[model samples]
Target chain A: MATKIDEEQLMNDMLCRVKAVNNMPHDIRATLLDFKVDGYKVGKVRPGIAEMLCNMKTSVFELKQEDDSKKKSYLTLTSDAGTSSEERTKAVGTVMNQLRDEGFVKGWRDELFPVSENFYSPPVFLMERAAVTVLGVLEYGVHINGIVQESRQDEPKMWIGRRSATKSKFPGMLDHIVAGGQPSGISLIDNVVKECEEEAGIEESIVRAGVQSVGAISYENWDPKSDKLTRAVQFTYDLYLPPDFEPKPVDGEVQGFMLWTMDQVKESMAMDYADPIKPNCYVVIIDYLIRTGQISPDSNGFLDILRELRSGDCQ
Target chain B: MATKIDEEQLMNDMLCRVKAVNNMPHDIRATLLDFKVDGYKVGKVRPGIAEMLCNMKTSVFELKQEDDSKKKSYLTLTSDAGTSSEERTKAVGTVMNQLRDEGFVKGWRDELFPVSENFYSPPVFLMERAAVTVLGVLEYGVHINGIVQESRQDEPKMWIGRRSATKSKFPGMLDHIVAGGQPSGISLIDNVVKECEEEAGIEESIVRAGVQSVGAISYENWDPKSDKLTRAVQFTYDLYLPPDFEPKPVDGEVQGFMLWTMDQVKESMAMDYADPIKPNCYVVIIDYLIRTGQISPDSNGFLDILRELRSGDCQ
Candidate 1:
């Protein structure tokens, strides 16, 4: 007899495939041109950078010729002009400002993200948070999910929020109680506490007392639309709230909040074809389900889901 | 400042590197040649199969020439000889018996393992449990870990076992209270109960009542010594026991049992340089630590470890 493909299995398979795409190495060698400075690999430069740089006539950057190995030529910062990390940061910042002014990039928050070989190393240089992906550099984020179960109930329920319609990405989609990207300065715990209050209107005292660190999920994806490579590590947290406490949207990013039972959450997750939740959020929920023993090993594709959840590198 | 590498992070990094090795894809396209039965990809035959087939003078099997794609030539079964699944099973069984007789293979068991594209697919054929790895076919195993904790403790201690000195694999090494591969014909729950009795001498009533399905971890590794690709899916279970109950080894596989605190377990896992436990078994214990909130997100390499745990595909 042929094996039966159940709803849970189908959902799990879909998530796994998504993870594979995200975890697959960025073939910058094949797609974007490789940029190097002073014998060190800097980052990937998008193809469109040539025309943009030409239009801006930047003194700090130049388009270099392909080497004998036939690797694609790249737009690199002039080493004579900016040899030091500080000078390079300043030079790149100037180009980023020009790009932002020309309407080539959006959402300039003045926040900086480190461009590094791996997370556990000193960054080569810092770039604007908005332009990190545009430059195809690795970035990291933190996602704090609140598990608000009624004290009297036998089964726990999860608190979920809807992204505001005005949000630039994943607007009107379901999200965790609180989620945000990790910028250069703040620590993970501090970020979680800050996001809890700003995103969910949760009190600082409650968040500090109840929040527990769970784990993380990482994935690397190339966005063809933006011609960017996005390598992200999402640090996940579980915050338990009092049963009677209701969450209000303090920040405009969240539209509304709702508490759903496990069955309801699973049902939502099983709609793999639908965009009920943001893509990465789906993985975080699946990880929660597996860790909490809601997704049993006997379930179809349980192993597939577990293996896919950790497919990417954290560094 | 240079990025601070903490002990936890270092341990997590070590675990991730180990997982990467285990999870890396086997280029079946490169090392072992592929064998096709009818049109379906049946199995991977080792390079040595050519000489072995010639030595045995087998009528059912023949070595095919390499194709234009430059793919490796394979030792395939003659179509006219084994059309039906049963016939194919019998034909392969005959060759496997011959190989065993010739001392090319070892550890022959009457038990069968299903060879399939994925865990959910209808198996192409059944092979002797011990011979599955010899053929380099994708294999699935269930690893049911008994999480025995004392009822009286504030922070529960775990029941761990040391393998017998006479055991062939991982002799005198640490192991779960109960663990065994999923043999054919037995359901996961039934196998868990049986393994619990045989390995840990747990009562049937206690196992049936306390055993809970948790999740699974999948990894693919190429065994250089045997020149075989090992694809495994371990179905993990958590069998909670009362604090006072002691685990006695019924089967001689386990030499002794000990109850260790979380700190002790962490210390053992942190010993990345030593093979304190079987490699894959280390992953299972890490999963346990993460699930029980012993390994926090704040812990160094926590994210790396989480991602590595789920780095392979079961399907």
Candidate 2:
């Protein structure tokens, strides 16, 4: 006889993996700097990154005293209120590119993400996708669960992707069929359609017709080693795939795709489960189960996990 | 031009109805008393009601000093640690019945609700259903969305009921097909099965087979005039009904049942929409929409409303 799964604990474990602040030492946590722009908090950075920014001797950075007693200062973009988004973007980009040159930032994706209050809001500025993480900037992305349901009566099967081992971040980890960062230029739905075609080789027509914008999950990822205090919002969608539809790796982002049942997905979510799913992908999948009632109200950890799912700064 | 519905604003309006504390005056909010039992907080009460309990001069309650400057006191159930649930219930019942006789509490249901940490935990004690509201006790219930779907291709239609005008709470307001309080003795699924039979004329077998425990929504309702500071969790279920399955109102708790299209359901959730749905029912439906993708990630108020949906003390 096997022991029953404590999904609540499993979810908490998953939560701790992404929202790493929970397990971080107090000293490391204490040294985290708030990244602000035009008086709006957009992200955070580690003390080392903050110190580097403070020493930049450039008009783009300003270290302001946030607390006198703690001798703590916050790293703020010197972009003033009423500055044009373009100017703000250029100012931030110059500093970010400098950090990249100094080897302080890694995984330099030339892509840019809107630094805004939320997913749909106009960007206060756009920062390079890779540099954004190091600055602990709020990042937004779209993740689609490409699911196959033979009929409405049957349990839906999800298409999971294994990221390319050579890729920069979470490489070779299991991922969604179509998941991509919400770059500054594209609409959320457009990002979905683009990622669908690029990552999973799904046509835009099939995606437009089948994709349903489901919900969003927000979480803060405090990885001191990565210099990331990232608060992220993943706008989630579900696309019902035909039984014959199979996801293939179009871009090298994914190595392969496999369709798994709800139970199989849950099994993978277990902390000790083999062939690990990407940490945040686990968050998205858990949310999907909650919506579909596979992980339901009767479950011991339902409410606890539900609250923790949005445990990050959403805006 | 037809103005678009501000679902977020609409949700906020609905939330204000149930989580009444937001619109309450500073004085009233200040006078609110915490209700604790055996060192665990389980409910709250307004000062007038708090004073009444203090004057009752019964061993059932103790009015203890909390904040001297604010002259604030918390009303605690005097049931000691290690007290048997049976003894705790009897002692509290005496205070509750006395409060009922004095015209402080009304709508006596002769029903009891378990006072626990969450839905599944063993209750510290059982409380009278009606008095639970006055004490602002943590409440739990099950609400089922009865929907008619002709086929997988068609949008599901909800079986919405008009509450009986004679009902004590939310009289004549719109409600779910099957909704009921989680009584002390019944399992959640059993309560759903029972409510289905009594409210919708649905059989136990049909309910057992059909009810999918989707999720739960928690909210706080503070109505000063009503003397309610209720923090409630409604465990939600979605039951698919065949086209021929017309919900006949078995009990007079409902005036009538009408199957509404998804659009109609959304219209009813609007603050200005005619025939307002029950306040917390609005919370549940919004959640359902979020899950089903009717209220997508792009909705301006999506995250705002989602966060506010669980704006109550869930545990």
Candidate 3:
């Protein structure tokens, strides 16, 4: 018989991956460059940007001495540079170009992500999504998982995919059927449909008919490798597939797809408690499991899992 | 034309009531008496107890000198006292009796609540449920709401209760059909069934047949009146009632019951944004609304609500 899974251990493992960034060392905290327009914070530059600017001797920005002890010293654009959204976007673009030249940011993408006072508000400016993390700006992502259940089945199975080995992040790890960041200018539903077609070869008609928005999970963590404070909110969706349907990877991004019973999925999650599932994807799965009653209230660590899944808000 | 409900405002109202206690002032924090056994913290005493012990000249506990900067100074039992679960319980019982005599606790309850390292673990000891909040220990509550939906109805209605004005806490506020804290030794399902029968006069068989555990919501707050840091986790359940079924208030705790459409519930929640529903009941309803798709993912403040509902984790 398989050893019983320790619910507390599983929950701790999941939370360790998504721990919130509430306390930062003064040195690490000092390196962040806050970008403000009209006294409102819109974005931030990742740590080590001060050194880069010093080496380049850029006259585009200057550090403002912070009078408030609580506020970190931030770089402000020169008065000659306008503070309009377009002007600020252009200034950030120039900074990104300089950073790229210095080999800080790799393979820059043109796709823009929103910089808003709050996640639900309208964007003040659209910065390149690829560069937003390097800037330590909060980003939003959308993930849709196909819960394909056969007719008359008591327990529903799910369609899961493994990322292609060639993928830059979390290669060979398990992922949802369709997942992508919420780049600026694209509606969430439109993005979901596009991801479904490109990543899993699911027809647009099937996806549109079956997709249902379940909920979202938010988490903020300090990415050690990039030295950036990554704040993200993932909109989760459930697409119910018909019994005869199977997902095939059209794009090379997904290596393979498999339908696993809920038990098998639980076992996979248990077995890979250390590092198999993508960190954010693990949170989505845990949310789905708790919502669907696969993880009963009586289960140990059920409350802990519920609390940790939304650790982002605390930050 | 019906006015559009301000979703963001409604969510903010709900969140404000359940805001987690993040920072405690030193004066307030100094009052809590920690209870530990074998170096593991099991429970805590509320503020003002130090004065009571001092006035009473109690020899039960002595304040330990702090050596580690990170560790909070705590009150440990005198060396004469035993550290066994039974002995510690008895010792706390003496403290409770002394407190009751001094009017620190009112209306002593026989129902014992679990004292655990965390919400999910087995209890180290059982203390009176009514005194759990007064003791500043984390407590768990269960809330089962009856979702009575008519066949072919697009919007399902819920059975809601108005608490009796004569009741002590949250008197005359709107509440779920059935809700109660988890007392030691009682199973969750058993508590759900018992609460249904007592609170709503629902037959036990019907509840057992239709009740399903949906998910849970957690929140922590510092209760100023009790001068205690209160942490709570609510296990939510949905009981699908027949369309024609009506809940009758069998117990005097509830003044009356009414079935309202989902839109009406939303309107009530929006109208009484400040203090209409019982604070914890509002959280359960929000969870229900989001899960049922009544609160669409595209709705304003939807993600913020998701984040705030689980804010208890970071505490």
Candidate 4:
């Protein structure tokens, strides 16, 4: 017998996990300090992160509180860093290196991401990609859902990736067909073509013709250690594949690819509580299902789930 | 000559108009009171509405202020109203009738709308549909876009309706092919079918097969007078029509129907700023444009628009 599904619970659980701090009813986020760069409040970090940065004893960040309440505290880059983004980035980088040596930050990807208020805005500064999530920065990326449909009778089949076992993150877990962090210099569509080719062995011409940018799913996650806030905006897309197309794994980012019927995708996402797809990308699939008219509007918590999908600082 | 479009400005203006109190830099909502029923904050009303309700001195409401500042005041249903939803509804209904008589309310639809925190929940009370918006409540409705796309070379054409001049609200304005409020008994899909047949003379079989529940666009609008708050969740859908199918205005609700290509539709929505489509339905169209990928991922304020599309209390 197949396991029964509590779809509302599954969705609520996923949303709460993906946007832990946002789903709270009370102002529990007051415990977190506003993280400022060059005097502009851009992100947030836990009290522990504030203390850690302060203990580094650098003039980089000045942590202050209000009215005898630690709850009202904030950390801002000092005037010493000045207004030049380059100077601020270099100053922050020096502190980050010290943090790495002291074992406070890890997983250095060497890829740098610009920190900004929104995706298309000018950067406040640049930070190492891997450290972006760990240091509570707003990160943006693209995720696409590839599917095949000849007609309604066949029930459109969607393509999903299983991360390689040796991968550093989300290993052996299911994910979207093509996903990558947004680095400076490349256009979003061009980046989509590049990632599609590198991750799924899809041709550039096919990707350019097939892919369509839908929108975005933003989430605010409290890292497992509960000391960092990871805010992410996944720019979503939908790619209609030729019925006969098959995706072979090109790079080791993904272990393998499989085509799942709409039913199978729903089952994996809604019923696979034992292990779900990467929490953030999991929401993108639900969004795709909704857009394709698979998820009924009468489903309980439909409104809540739709809103929570973009629950973070969506801009 | 075609008018150049400032898509970002158009969307921002529509969103600001639809969700006025929401798109603020700070919480101007502090001016409004939490309208409570059965001790639950089910809605929010302008301070004027609160005072108007209490002025009657009917023992139905007891307004309280916090910190001697009106900022934190809430109007609650007195204990005399009891916990019986039916009794509370009857008591509130009596007041609604009186308010209508005194000209504080208008447009009695003779339709009843349930009061609850979210859809698919038991009612806290049932109020007249017309007063639901004037009195501040979360209203639910369904809107669908009907389109025909035979191939890639031909841009998809969508069917839109022009409201009859005789209608009281948004007369002669552009609207979706089929849209209706969610009543108490019918299923959402069934509501779509009923509205489709009644408004567009579409056959039941065709609507049942072609129409789909895509998702929702919720917005919070402060009425033109900036008094009442109208929080609405419009469940959206997409219906694929046969290439030859054309919608005829039925039941005198619509003046006529027009089929516009995607470019035409985008132009009407993005460029016709002097006289735009109905504000709430306008949001539904932007959502459709995004889902179909007509709006690029790199558009400025892409993230903000996506989030604000469902800017109301979605649940």
Best by TM-score: 4
Relative to the unseen true structure, what is the C-alpha lDDT of residue B65 in candidate 2, on a scale of 0 to 100? Answer: 70
Q: Summarize candidate 4's per-residue lDDT along A1-315 as a digit string, tens digits.
A: 235556676556544544443442234465767777645667777777777777776648778655454447778777776678898888888888777777767777777789876677789888777676545788888999997875443467789888889887778988888898888878898899999999999998788777778888776766545466777778888887887888889988998888877656655654335756776677788888878877777877666667766556533
Reference-based TM-score of each model: 0.82, 0.86, 0.83, 0.91
Which has the better TM-score: candidate 1, or candidate 2?
2
Ranking by DockQ: 4, 3, 2, 1
Q: Is candidate 1 or candidate 2 better by DockQ?
A: 2
- TM-scores of chain A in all candidate models: 0.79, 0.84, 0.82, 0.87
Q: Give the distance in Å from residue B111's predicted Cα in candidate 1 to where it truly belongs.
A: 2.1
Rank by TM-score, descending?
Answer: 4, 2, 3, 1
**Model 1 CAPRI quality:** acceptable
How displaced is residue B269 in candidate 3, in Å?
1.1
**Tens digits of per-residue lDDT for model 2 on A41-139?**
777778777777767755477788765577677878664423888888887788788878878777888887788755556888887887776677777
- C-alpha positional error of residue A291 in candidate 4 after TM-score superposition, expressed in Å: 1.6
For candidate 1, the C-alpha RMSD (Å) to the true structure equals: 5.4
Which candidate, 2 or 3, would have the higher lDDT against the true structure?
2
Pairs that collide in candidate 3 are none
Query: What clash pairs does model 4 have?
Result: none
Once model 2 is optimally superposed onto the true structure by TM-score, how far is the C-alpha of residue B189 displaced, in angstroms? 1.9
TM-score, B chain alone, candidates in order: 0.79, 0.84, 0.83, 0.87
